[model samples]
Target: MTLTLVTGGTGHLGRDIVDRLVGDGHHVRLLARSPGARPDVEWAVGDLATGVGLSDALQDVDTVINAATYSPIARRGGVRPVDFFRSPSAVDVEGTERLLSLCQRQSIRHFLHVSIVGLDDATLPYARVKLAGERLVRASALSWSVVRAMPFYYLLDKMITSFAWLPLWPMPTTSFNPVDTSDVADHIVACAFDGIFGERTEIGGPQDISIAELGGQYRDARGLHRKILPVPMSEAKARGMGFVISRGARGRLTWADWLQHRYSVTHQAA
Candidate 1:
């Protein structure tokens, strides 16, 4: 039996990965900030940033699915790019470096990393750091598969909320194939089990929707009659957001489907 260790198993996508791997009968270990319990998950208290409690978590681990990240860029206000947890350089890049070093010593076979799509044309400080992290993983001796995912629908919710106080939603002209987090999780699980390494797979949603159109859909979904204002951006900046989908497992769920099903249900409950 293959023993798989999942970093950040407590996270949104991490938990789903844990369930998927365990359901497929893979022995799963979770690297968490503190010890926790689930039916099949073995918990190893560890810190990705500081490299503490790593050995205990990685002992005899065969494969690793690194899902850990520190992304606070959505509502970036008065934040310095390199200041502590506010930037991916501190948590994403450094933590991935620490985890990769551990995975190397443990002689881990496959390292499946979760990364965002626009890492190469990264305009944001976090995206650049994430790309840096990917470079490190690729440069390492461990066999690896990187899945570059699109902007999650949940992030769109934040984008809508941030403009809630304003009369008009100043939506970015940049487009995105906003995907369901679950779909991304499933793809990661597939990569983990398929034993395919040294491949970078990019996954995204069904249709490309500009931020303005997405905001319009969101406004309609939430019963908000707010005007959708398309905020024009520089071509260079639009290119940097990296929304164009080249290829991979396309998501079955659309933005409208997600809004009607997930967002509306959650928002109504709130």
Candidate 2:
């Protein structure tokens, strides 16, 4: 069985990927900052920022999936925080560079880096960093695939809520090709073992939906009367709020704004 080492194995997406890898009969090793009990998989204590536990984490591993991400960005009052970019870069970019270097030394076969769609034009610092991280992977000699994914349904639920205890959603006018996290995990597994290599692929949901439409669907799903507000806010405002929110919220919303504005004109034409 192929031994796969997954960074950020405890995260929502990472856990799903690990679960699939384990179910497929592959030996999975998880690199995490904390030492916790994960009965199903082997856990290696490692901190990406300090380069701790990296070598041991990569030992005997065949492939590495960089699934690490910071907490959401949230506002305290109105000021956008700097921790949003700082923390992500520390873990996402610098930590990724270290991992890639290790992979190069170990002759790891495949390196799959997870990224968000429309990273090229994303104004948020997180996207910019992610874009930079992608470039770093491309520069490496190790076989690599940069998988860019659209927003997930879970993300929508986490981002908004309704008064009837339902999930109210807010979407930009820009279009989204939301893909299930499971689909993304499946695609990653495919790329890990059996697919074209050294190419970037954009993965999204089967159907494209606007932010407003997505919000409406969530409202309908819960059978709530909450209005799906399509606030015509500028990209700047959206991005600004992204920076000010919780670290986890920051990355997701920043990318959301970036995707919306980057595809706004194209979506309009379609």
Candidate 3:
């Protein structure tokens, strides 16, 4: 059996990848900072930030899917001025370097990196760090591929949910192609199986919708009617948030489709 190593296996996208891989009978090893009870997969306790237990995790691994990233600003729910300058060097940059070095030493067959779209046009400090990581993969001696994915719908759900209670919802006029995690996972798994090399792919949702429109859909799903205040931002800055997908594989789910399923489940449980 071919052993595959997955970094960030417990995350939103990572979990879906791991599940699909395991379901397909691929020998999967997950690199996680702490122990988890997800069944039918080997767990390697490791910290990407500290480079701890990475060597052990890379042992006998034929392929590596690096989905790990650190973003405190987004994870913590709000961005601060100080966070604007802070890059996720510890995990995304330095950790990628560490993993690639070990992959070379161990003669890993293929390396798959998960990234965000519009890094080149985006102005975010975090985008720069992730772009740097992609550069490392492209320049590495190991056979590598990069998959740039659009923002997930769950992320937008969180953003919209945060302000649903307000009398007026403030949203950027910028639009993005929000996708389902499962769709991105399916693409990653296919790439891994084919052992694709030197290829960069982008995946996004089926339609391009503005943030304000998405917010309105969310409010309607939850039965809330609130005024929408479109936040003014420069075109370049809005592009940094996410880009409209002119090309690449579009996901099967639309925002309205996802919203309907989301609230339908909630309503059923209630």
State which candidate has the highest TM-score. Answer: 3
Which lDDT tens digits does candidate 3 get at residues 1-270? 999999999888999999899889999999998879977889999998899999999999999999999876557655668766766688988899999999999999999999988788877788888999889998999999899999888877876766566889888777778899999999899888784587666899888888888888888787776889888767877877555553688889899988998998664211
Over 4 Å off, model 2: 74-87, 162-171, 231-270
Pairwise TM-score winner, candidates 2 and 3: 3
> Can you write out model 2's per-residue Cα lDDT over 167-247, one digit (the tens) per residue?
343456655566567777887777778756775556666665566776665554444576565756576555443311111
Span of ten consecutive residues with least summed lDDT in model 2: 243-252
Question: Judged by lDDT, which candidate is best?
Answer: 3
Q: What is the C-alpha lDDT of each candidate?
A: 0.79, 0.68, 0.85
Give candidate 2's error at residue 225 in angstroms: 2.8
Off by over 4 Å in 3: 231-233, 267-270
RMSD of 3: 2.2
